[model samples]
Target: MDLEVGDKVSLIIGTETHLGFTVLIDESFEGLLYRNEIFEELKENQRIAGYVKNIREDGKIDVSLQPQGFRNAIELDTEKVIEAIYDHDGFLALTDKSDPEDIKKELRMSKKAFKRAIGSLYKQKQIVIGEEGLTLVKE
Candidate 1:
């Protein structure tokens, strides 16, 4: 694909970003995501994912790998989810999950993606859904 600044890409295991010990994208390109730029706390080898935000003249390409589309794109889900889980009880109903829906209304993703994130949070046991609403399982 024509990789340029502000393009989204995925990185699998055993890749290098050329800049450092990053899990590279396309197994060749170097991603440009910094810790401060990420809304989520990136763990070591946690798989840096974002968009390509720059391409330098030195033949090194810069990628964001952020799940969010671009700078102009709506903010990502994980951050919002974390915020909602912390602000609310973490029991957002499929029908009453307002904060996540605020994101959805802007992002235009299928419901599947939204629910998948909830499933991920559930799997991580970070949050639990109940009749009371979504509640944070951990701090």
Candidate 2:
């Protein structure tokens, strides 16, 4: 296989399964996009960018919609959170104490990622965390 772990590839959504969605990678390889790793809705025959997450010993490929590694994930997630805040009139009703499910529903990301992004924003003075949630700090 020409694909290696972390390789970016084009994916064509195939079928939905109990575990996740089956996809065709670069129109040649079969891969699985696990449900837990998915954050957005996907439809059959839809094409999207994906990263090679793993290649099992048995030849099954695991793919992800997001890039691998903490740096990449953090940057992307941070931007997403920032954008969400902007979209919501600079106030996001999500705090550290917010329910994980609520955060996931609102942000389509894990609570941990939300926390990290909020923390970064706080450090940069880009946002303020309060009893009401996250408020974008106006410059």
Candidate 3:
């Protein structure tokens, strides 16, 4: 398939499996996108951009919605959190202590990713993490 790890590819969303959604990669390869890795709702026949996470020796492929590196993922997740906060009048009721399902439902992100993004935002002094929620730091 000439595909390598981290290669960008197109995916046609397929049926849901216990593990994840099956996808048609580039309309040629069959790959699986794990449920835990997904942050948004996907429907059958949905088309989206994806990256090749792995090509198993058994020929099964694994794909990811976010680009495979910490830098790329953190940046995107941070932006999403920022936007959500802004949309909520500069505060979002989510914190590191929030339930993972709550974070996923609210932000479509895993708690780990949410924590990393919030950590980045906190380090940048862009947001304040309080017991109530996250507040955008005003200049």
The prediction achieving the highest lDDT against the true structure is 3
| Best prediction by TM-score | 3
Candidate 2 or 3, higher TM-score?
3
lDDT of each residue in 40-133, candidate 2, tens digit only: 7899999999999999999999999888888888889889989999999999999999998988899988888889888888998999999979
Tell me the TM-score of model 2: 0.91
Q: What is the lDDT of candidate 3?
A: 0.95
Pairs of colliding residues, candidate 2:
none
The 0-to-1 C-alpha lDDT of every candidate, in the order given, reads 0.53, 0.92, 0.95
lDDT digits (tens) for residues 35-92 of candidate 1? 3333333455565456766677786655553444532432355455666655555544
| Error at 98, model 2, angstroms | 1.8
Native-vs-model 1 lDDT? 0.53
- By TM-score rank, best first, the candidates go 3, 2, 1
lDDT tens digits, residue span 14-81, model 3: 99999999999999999999987898989999999999999999999999998898999999999999
lDDT at residue 2 of model 1 (Cα atoms)? 65
